[model samples]
Target: MNILFYNDSQDQLFHISPRQRRVALAVALIMAFLTLAALFFAGTKLPVMSAFFPVLGAWGVMGDVLTSFILFNQFRSSRIFPLLLLACTFLLTGILSLFYLLSLTGMLPLSGLFASGSQTAVWLWCFWHSCFPLGILLFMGSLHFNKKIIDRRLLPRYLFSGTTAVLLIGVLLLALATAGQDKLPVLIEDGNYRRLIETAVGPAIWALCALASVCSVFPYKKRGVLRVWLSVAVFAFLLGVTLSLAAGERYTLGWYGARIDSLIASTVVLLSIISEVNKLFVRLRRQHEELEESQQALESANEQLKELSGIDSLTRIANRRKFDEVLKQELNAPQRAKEHLSLLMIDIDFFKAYNDHYGHLGGDMVLRSVAPRLEAEALAHFGFTARYGGEEFAIILPGHSELEAEQIAELMLESVRSLAIPHQYSDVSDQITISIGGCTLRPGEKSNAHDFIGRADEALYRAKHEGRARFVFANSARDSCLHPFETTSH
Candidate 1:
């Protein structure tokens, strides 16, 4: 039923849920038992059961019409050729069934329309059964045609106009051909005549049925629920035809069995459609959850990338860019205007000589060893440390005066000396040491990151000039530079 709505081009059978699979198995087993029982007792007929034939026929008509509506709606949404054909087939079958049912009940306005129990009704009956199979054959044959031939924008118009024309033509021909011909020779009177008619019409219906079965197989070659059920539908159709032939008389037990077979065959596709719909909803929900999870994972990865961008790759600390950004933010921040902030400039003394003697690789190890100590001391003092450039690092301490900044710098100096990294090429003690320059100020509207950094750099130069292993303070007053006792240490 949903074969027309199928979007997958891979020629595989449609999937179904476990629950649907179980339902299909139950339906198949019941249908199989019904077919066997009907065949086993072909001659026996209960008048009560036979009386309900009309009711069952009415139900079959309604089912086909409803199924047609569903298929047509699907056709409108998907614009698939197979869906359109199936919808039309069901609709036409429903109409034909109505005509046949009206004749059986003697309610048709056209009394000449193959009047009940008449010879012409036999021919019409055979023709009615053949109509749906022919439509199925047409659908199967056209599957290989170019899809572009049916323009979607004009499809509804074509369908309406084309079906109208065909219906009108068929009605006109049926009326004209059968007019005044109700009294024709008996179609089933003589055994030879019956055999002749059967031989002539039987092959045509069987050939169409065979072709339809072939078509069903072509679409779903892969093993799956849809393929299994579709094959069952086609087999049921063939079995119904067989039962009709074996009945050998109208209104017999075999005839009722044939009708039951037709009903089951027609409904198999509809049952599959319902099952497939449930599975589709389940799959869509799973896919939606997966999509949401993937989006969240992507957001998390992007945040990690953003953080990495602001960090130095070698030392895994805040880089120069991060330091510059923070310095600008601190200088302009209104909340910190009256609050003391200090910048410390620390340089590894004789780093170039150290790199040359120990090689750049060993110098990189010494730099990595020294950075964590500096970062820990700055962080403990409620500050952030960054690698300002090669051989130099800067710490930004908010709410820290010059005296408090000096203490933080002392801790960092001690932390580096504690490492006691050997430096054979140093002019100072044969271990790594850093010169510290400390600058403290209360930021104002006029304060800039460049000037703040320049004062610290100048202090650092002063510290290096005096001796390479001591701390100096750059006074904010333009005329004054202070040395914190110049406690030089190695």
Candidate 2:
């Protein structure tokens, strides 16, 4: 749904959705079929001719040819590629028919001027035959090279080989043509410099086409090299045509001009196909990178959600559920490991009375204050702490003995007492304080975590009953005695 704007310098907008891919594929296939049909029926041999038919036929054929080329090179596995390649072969045959039509339609001005028995006619016939096979070979070669480079990462190696092959073959063919031209007396006798130029130009144009085809395999950064070769090919074709016309043997000039025009048009079309293929690759790569980034962002968000779920929202610590799980794990450790485990049960003294006098908000502030103080004391003793319930918290000291546990409890009591907030309506004492009760147990001592916790709770009950501001050891007999004031009342 998000809109993205690409400046003119950038490649076209890439459609990434499955629906768009299907649509593009369908368009490509339809174009391929139409091009094939036009190429098949577009000549004098096909007698169903309406006046508008040939023009419509040429447009359909051109559209099909270009679309087929695009689908084959840019989306090889698409149903479009194989279909288009097949259509292109038929399309080439139709172009051959058009060449024959041009000869029959008397549009070839040079054919009558050069007598039927003349060497010029023979050379023209040979050249015409060469054109069909040459066009087909170049088309197939370009497509084969394009597919190989597109589907494989070893572009440099294949490109080097293809380029070398094209260069050698093109130079050899040009040399053979030039040598043959030297012996054509009709060319020599008539001073037909145009025929000589045509003979020389054909090989150079083909060479340049081959070079352009090979250059298309390179990455964008190196495409300028390919562009340079194509420019050379275009210059040779144009210069050769100009030189042929200037040489002024009327018959030779007309014949060479027709061939030059066909070569130039085909070269332009092939170059356009290469450019579009490059554009498509660039767009697809960008979309792939964006998808990877989005996936990474999603993974990070999921990990954070998992962390948040295990944390206590109000206290910003591990919740009671997490605490129980960790406690059970510690309690189940093997006895031979000789580990000492301690638990502390802490309560904010006279919390109910405090809440009644100052309101629940004030009770919350007191609870918040007491929890952190206990946390700091527990951390100082290298223990873990969590809020056990409203106004109560628990700390686990995994390696601490009974003496160390008692000492930590005393430290927590002192830390809370030091807060020194006044509590005027409390029966226990006049200052806000905490009661801490802790128990230390060894692993494999026939004690479950619940038993250890129950002992700590019992001591906590005794601490609250006995003046409410002191630490009570779980096994101490003094913890079993009630407060002196409460005992007197009983």
lDDT string, candidate 2, 1-490, tens digits: 0001123111112323454335433533453354334333322132233333334334433543553344334333322222233334324423433333333333334423321223433244234334434543454354434332133444334345533544454334333333343355443234333454456644554454445434332333222222232233333333333333343442333333334333443344345445545767888899999999988996896577447546666666556876786688678866416877888888887888999999988887787777788878887887878888888888989888777787777677667777877888777767787787877786546577778899999988877776677667787534322231333111
- Residue 7 error, candidate 1, Å: 6.8
Deviation (Å) of 452 in candidate 1: 32
Encode model 1's per-residue lDDT on 126-189: one tens digit a residue. Answer: 5557777777666555555634335679887967964675466446434532553354434465
Q: How well does candidate 2 match the true structure in TM-score terms?
A: 0.35
Give, for candidate 2, the lowest lDDT window spanning 10 residues: 1-10
**Candidate 2 stretches greater than 4 Å from native:** 1-309, 477-490
- What TM-score does candidate 1 reach? 0.51
Give the TM-scores of the predictions, in the order they appear: 0.51, 0.35
